[model samples]
Target: MAPPRAEWLASSFACLLLYGFWGFLGKLALVRGLSSSQEAGLEKLGFFLTLPLILKPSATDPNAGPGLMERPKFALLAAYMSGVTAAAADFFYTRAMMKGDGGAVSAITASYPPVTMVLCATFMREKVTRNKLMGSFFTLLGAFFMARS
Candidate 1:
């Protein structure tokens, strides 16, 4: 039998919360004791360990196609760029948090989704619904208020 929609939604949301905390905690750990290169090495080691567990089933499955080694160079390039961007963002975020008020920095960072949505709408010709506009306005306002406090 299929799971209920609400059950799926709740489970997804819970997973998101857990994953978000996981990233945050990892960043905190990296910020605590390691230089960027050390942090990257540690993360790569963790990935090597964890990824194989997830990939093992697919590796054994006859229906699955060729492994990631068969993928084009551009795919690896894109993944590398993603990692670079994430590392840069984390470095800046940690700097901001350490230098300024965490609450204010968090508020400003939380405002990013609205700014991203606006940019996407402008550049990608994506539809900007009224509700989205209102949410963006409120997010900015809340961030502004938080920063002012």
Candidate 2:
């Protein structure tokens, strides 16, 4: 079942705040001379630590659906690849932040939503509305200006 509107909004707000803190803390660590690899490794450790707090045993929890290995092969492949890609992206982002202005690097990376939109449209046959096109144009333009700094 889908979340209620309020619940969804609250979760979205929480994500926004957490992600904002994630970037700020990452930049702070990078500035303090943490190597990108170290930052990525430690960050991944923190990520793993969160899993036990949330994951419940399927045997005890009726809602705890199928185990990971029981999922479709394509889904598992996609999830695994996404983890790899996200880690690589985090590493590269931290490397960039080590030398570049955090704001500039973040702005450039923030432009990824446009790339995601385009990819979805191309690969998933998602509709491309005019509003999305205009938003993408403005988003890219803003990123370009920020990156020039």
Best by lDDT: 2
Clash count of each predicted structure? 0, 0
* Highest-scoring model, TM-score: 2
Model 1 error, position 137 (Å):
1.3
Q: Candidate 2: lDDT of 69?
A: 87
lDDT of 2 by residue, 1-149 (tens): 55569946998889878877888898898778888888878888999999998675756565568777888999889889999999889878888988898878888877787889988999999999888999999989998898895
Stretches of candidate 1 above 4 Å error? Answer: 1-12, 19-79
Show model 2 residue runs off by greater than 4 Å. 1-9, 56-64
- Name every residue pair that clashes in candidate 1: none
> For residues 1-149, could you state the per-residue lDDT of candidate 1 as single tens digits?
56669956997888768655645655575558765456555756776799868666545565577667787888779789978977787666665654556567767765776877977898889899887889999999998998896
Candidate 2 lands at a TM-score of 0.83
lDDT of 1 at 56: 61
Which window of ten consecutive residues has the lowest lDDT sum in model 2? 54-63
